[model samples]
Target: MKLREWVEAGDDARLLVIIEAQDVLSVELLRRQLRDMGEVSCSEQQAGTWQLGLLAHSCGSLDVCLARVQGKVAALNRGRAAAPAELVETRLVSAAAASLACAPMIIGPFTLVSQDELECGPRQIRFDGGKAFGSGSHPSTRLAVTLLERTAAELVPARVLDIGCGSGVLSLISARLGARHTVGVDICPDSLAVARRNVERNNLSSRITIT
Candidate 1:
């Protein structure tokens, strides 16, 4: 959700920089420029022939913010624009960041946990934010982590199994829970690479094996 989400559960000072276009990459660049203005979170979905979205930010004023966003959109339209339908139009909204709902998450020591906004046990978990699939988010991985934590004493299976392991992080979690033997497998080489990095970062070489 970041700072780019607005009009849901956020504050009243933020603005939305909405861009619509047929070119996805061009729209993405516009989104990046919006970030330069302030904190931004965006969502995109294909609506018939056009791409629809909402870019969230906290620009100072409506006019000034619109000017900034429009100028950036013009810059993005220069050379890389493709097809006649790919141009984008921008709009500004003075919405608050509190209006949008963002799943609150925290990572610490070596784990990531998500909780309700009202519940604030830990503040932030600084991670490398790598390409790994598990940055301590996702339901299935969280479920598996809970399983690992609860059954640490009863489970005797040396080799663990994680189906649909993104970034091979489930194995890293299993190893963290004291699994003596661990191996992670995945179809995505990038995800595997991410899993491997997580394992090495934790220094669980003797316990965790990732591929």
Candidate 2:
């Protein structure tokens, strides 16, 4: 299903299911299992909780979708699930944009800009706020970016490796900061896809590799 369509569905749209778990592993597993049923996105929440959001089409009823998701969550967590899947409000895109806007994080020379904002200057990274993580909003990602910037001069003309790369932000930034080549590795195929798109968005395909 097209996520844009779901986001724009308005009042006629079926409610989207948001499943919460305490750990990233459960979130990842739920994402893998429920992806085929709809569009799934996972993110880390406060208090060590992780959320898996599934945006399903209005073609089916909300109850049916919730039941299916609950069953999947049960299978993954074996009755230890943190919480049941709930129906979230509409305007999914707006909600996502707001979440990103809540924290305008600056990482080194790059500043993460929201969709509504324009890139007023150079060294700005724009994220569409897609399913993959790493919009530079998280503390860990910001820290990594800061560390990379501090050592960017030393990393010039060198090959850099990024493990668990999300949204390929680090790899892209590394390439921008003078790394001759960057290799981003992630276990999630969905994350790799998002990273590849981000790499292409910044027009650094040749300098960065996402796998």
Highest lDDT, which number?
2
TM-score, prediction 2: 0.54
Superposition error at 167 for model 2 (Å)? 7.0
Cα error, residue 132 of model 1, in Å, equals 3.5
Compared with the true structure, all predictions reach lDDT values of 0.50, 0.66
For candidate 2, the 10 contiguous residues with the lowest summed lDDT are 93-102
Model 1 regions lying over 4 Å from their true place: 1-129
Q: Candidate 1, 3: how far from true, in Å?
A: 20
> Per-residue lDDT tens digits of candidate 1, residues 107-200?
2223332111233223222222234455443445556767777787654566787665665556665665667788777788877776666566
Any idea how many clashes model 2 has?
0
* Model 1 TM-score, all chains together: 0.42
